[model samples]
Target: MPGREARPAVEAQLLLASCKGGGPMQKRFLFFLALLLIVSLGLLAACGQPTPEVIKETVVVKETVVVEKKPVKLVMSFVPSGDTQQIITGGEAIERLLEEKTGYEIDTNVATSYAAVVEAMGAGNADIGWLNTFGYILAHEKYGVEVILATVRFGRPYYTGQIIVRADSGIKTLEDLKGKTMCWVDPLSTSGYVIPRVMLQAAGIDPDKDFAKTVEAGSHNNVVIAVYNGDCDAGATYVDARRTVEKDLPDVMEKVAVIAESPQIPNDTVSVRKDLPPEVVETIKKALLEIAQTEEGKEALKQVYEIEDLVEVDDSFYDGFRATLDAAGVNIEELAK
Candidate 1:
């Protein structure tokens, strides 16, 4: 093997070239084999070193990962308010305001049904909503929606549910409503169905059974119009619902009368999906608060819900709604049906 040393070098070069080109699998396999051989040789060599004294302390290594923030994009929905386009036009203003103020991308939807809005939140299609108090509770209970803020109608943060009758209708009191056609708004409507039902039941009238017939008018305004036109003997709606139609039905005040009013209920809620970042919730609430401070903003708020201010409301504020539902024997889950 005097001049044969070059044969071993040539063999090594040929073996490396065989594994290197046009064959990733082969190359990787060879790499692992070589790594295993090197590890085995290293272990053999390490046996010659004297054993080191064991240290009593354990060392922990921490790793930090930096993730870039993604752009905040969301959709907002509201239960339909008779004028779907008006809600859109008004909601669009809030979208624009939010985009400008918080750098978020927002899309607006005026949901056809209150339950649809709740579904939107649960399905992750909607990140925020302008929900009536009962709608919020249903969404919160069923879908984990988190309350961000509440609306102030006109100037107060609370309003009453009123059962109104035509001004000239022979019906002067709740008793007169018995065996008469009654109009109710959506089932999800707090002021439209739940509160007025409670009022009727308190007066010894069963809305489901006593009324000659009951029909849904869809929205508060429709409930008012139904009574104004004598289409129904009586209808339930939020207080001052007649005022909302006076401009169109100029005799709205003269034609409609509030026969009974429910106790003051908490105002509608400005809610976000529970999974939303707290900062995003704060940003949205802040932008809405700022929206109520200017003339232009005031007009936008008015178009949405005649809102004058947005105030922070915690879960405790909505506890009364729960009590009312329980006391009336209304099942929150059944309403979803």
Candidate 2:
């Protein structure tokens, strides 16, 4: 009875064995083997076909090449003209001129303050710059800037400083400004402060110890307005600013007259970093001095500096400026202080 009962279990085992021997597993294995044989036969048949001798020839091939391009860049900066606002617009004109002359792209920068432009030069932000006599001196002393060209005023390579007062106020000479209020355009202004100070000293008056009150008007036009509006008894600015104020703001200009004019001071100049390549600097200097010969260049010069030409000048021209500052006993160190 036990053997007969276990007969069902034995039949089930035999069924499993039959399934393992003839299931989809065996079919899949057979199918795979047949496909592999077909692929092998196809490869053998393909190998029996002839390969062209021309196609089998060995040949050398060259490698591909590539090149990198460099970028062109230049930056020019200048302080605002004391009154004309020409320095800002003038910079744009000069940038165009430089591009035309050198075929190099340039970006122009304008500083509200001349000293700030000098700071840009020290920081290596401006590749080329325009600076007043005092600003140029500071840059040369502090940063070794090289002066390349200077403006010609009244057909001379230098300009003058003028102390002005209201035409009706009767402040007629350097002596008259004593014990009176005064407005100096800017501390770094050569004619506006430095040269005027020298003129005052020549008359035996000290600007710091003499003026009842001193104020910095920040621009030559502001200095003129300060005098015209009776804000100060006298105002000092570059002599050239008077002409611009007369042309641009005639009413305001008519109310003021020059009471005293300082001795000749070298005009503003264009400078480059001393470390620049001499050849490049020379090229730039040549273009600048020669600008007056071309129609566009002449127009730009008139627009910016209001001059017919610029001349190549050396640092020696500024020696008189330094001497004038010294003669007045004005220590630039004290000015900064």
Candidate 3:
């Protein structure tokens, strides 16, 4: 009986050992070989298909674009007129005229003071300027500004500076200003100060040493008004200064008397920086002359400078202005600031 029991257990062990033999190992090896064969066939089939060709191409463009550039910008500086709004509006109008006539781009600047415009010329900030006779002299001699045109006010290429007194003040001559309070518009005024000073000297009176009090009334209109109001015994201003205040003081002409008249004075000038191209200068002058011929243009310019026309002129026309300054012993280098 014991032998029979051990015989069954031994049989079980033999069967288990037989299961672990070549059958499972051969099956696993065959499976891996089949998988590798399938992978190889897939790769070969993929390689057998025709490969697509790559093509490169070049393209050409055949159009051209041409650009036209505009002219250089021109900037003009101004010494302000009586009215601020009038000065600005008139300046813009004139800039428009320049552009329309010259085919140029134009801009404008109204300097805070007359000397500011002069300094702008010296610094090359301005290409053109509106300068008074004395201011033109200062800019020409010191800053290389050239007068291109002379502004004509009231149809005259020349004007006169005057010494004015209230009509009742029996002060009839320049000598009467000797021991009295004197008002001068400003040192820069050719008519108001410079030319009148020369006139006073020619009459054998020293403006510096003779006057009891020398007052700067600030402007030509103010100079006339102060004399008319009896604030000043006598004053110097442009001969046309009474016209400036005629509307305000309708009897301005009746109230103020011209004690003396200065020698013929050149009108204000239209100037340009000296280094500008001559052709360009001539073009500007031409445009300005055309502007003068049109009534609307004159009316527009009148607000700024009372200019009715622009006339051809030479620098020699201002020689008298220089001589007057010289006769007064005025050192421009000292007076210009």
Which residue pairs collide, candidate 3? Answer: none
lDDT of 2 by residue, 1-337 (tens): 4464455445544544555466698756655655565565556556667896775777889888877654446688877655446766766887888877776678987787888888888878887888888988888888888899888768888878888888899777888888999998877888888788878888988888998999988888788877878998888887757666676567766688887777778889888876777877887887776666788887877777676788888899888778877766766555443
Rank candidates by TM-score, best first.
1, 2, 3
Better of 1 and 3 by TM-score: 1
Global fold similarity of model 3 (TM-score)? 0.74
Total backbone clashes of model 2?
Answer: 0
Task: Give the residue spans of candidate 3 off by over 4 A.
Answer: 1-71, 81-85, 331-337
lDDT of 3 by residue, 47-144 (tens): 66789988888788878988888696888987753444666777888889989998888899787766777888888899999888898999988888
Ranking of models by lDDT: 1, 3, 2
Kindly report which residue pairs in candidate 2 clash with one another.
none
What 10-residue stretch in candidate 1 is worst by lDDT?
Answer: 1-10
- Regions more than 4 Å wrong, model 2: 1-69, 251-254, 331-337
Q: Please give the distance, in angstroms, between residue 133's alpha carbon in candidate 2 and its true position after superposition.
A: 0.9
- lDDT, candidate 2, at 272: 88
Q: What is the lDDT of candidate 1?
A: 0.84
